[model samples]
Target: MSELSMGDALKLFLQKSRLKGSMQAMQITDIWAELMGKTIARYTDKIQILNRTLFIATSVAPLKNELLFQKEKIIQRVNEALGENLITEIVIR
Candidate 1:
């Protein structure tokens, strides 16, 4: 087979890491849940994980604001969950 273009590769990744399914993995979801907690998770959704970074989308602007407000803390909490700094950045949009 030929190599995948960036877009194709990303599409395939999204397919495999079905947000709900990906959340099933203890390593990924537990850590995520732990960091954000139930209340925050309800409002925010993990949209993508690319280049070792996490991208989240929030329905509530306040949650987005909170994440921005506690950027460093959130980063640290997420890093702690992953046991290493897998996510270098968190984007809220």
Candidate 2:
């Protein structure tokens, strides 16, 4: 038997389980509302992750503008929440 580093072993487990994407997606969705606050979540029409980017649909134009201005800050908050640099960008529509 051989010893494996914690990071390497976890990576192998995630790869074999095929849960990495789904788990991360779920985590982001669950945290979005909490981090953004109730008012923002109410304005958010929908959200999804694809290809390392977060896609968010806003119900109102003002909300879109607000999010656009805070996009980088929001991304940083999300990465800090997840404890991983998972998202590269946010697409608001």
Say which candidate scores most in TM-score. 2
Each candidate: what lDDT?
A: 0.68, 0.87
The parts of candidate 1 lying over 4 Å away from their true place are 1-26
Which pairs of residues collide in model 2? none
Pairs of colliding residues, candidate 1: none
Off by over 4 Å in 2: 2-12, 15-17
The residue-by-residue lDDT of candidate 2 on 1-93, one tens digit each, is: 899999999988986886887877888889888989999988897878777798899879988999999999988988898788888899999
Q: What is the lDDT of residue 37 in candidate 1?
A: 80
RMSD of 1: 8.7
Cα lDDT for residue 22, candidate 2 = 80
Best by lDDT: 2
Task: Write model 1 residue lDDT over 1-93, tens digit each, in one string.
Answer: 899999888767855775523442345655566667878877776556666666778888888888888877876777676556756787888
Q: State the weakest 10-residue window (summed lDDT) of model 2.
A: 15-24
TM-score of 1: 0.62
lDDT of 1: 0.68
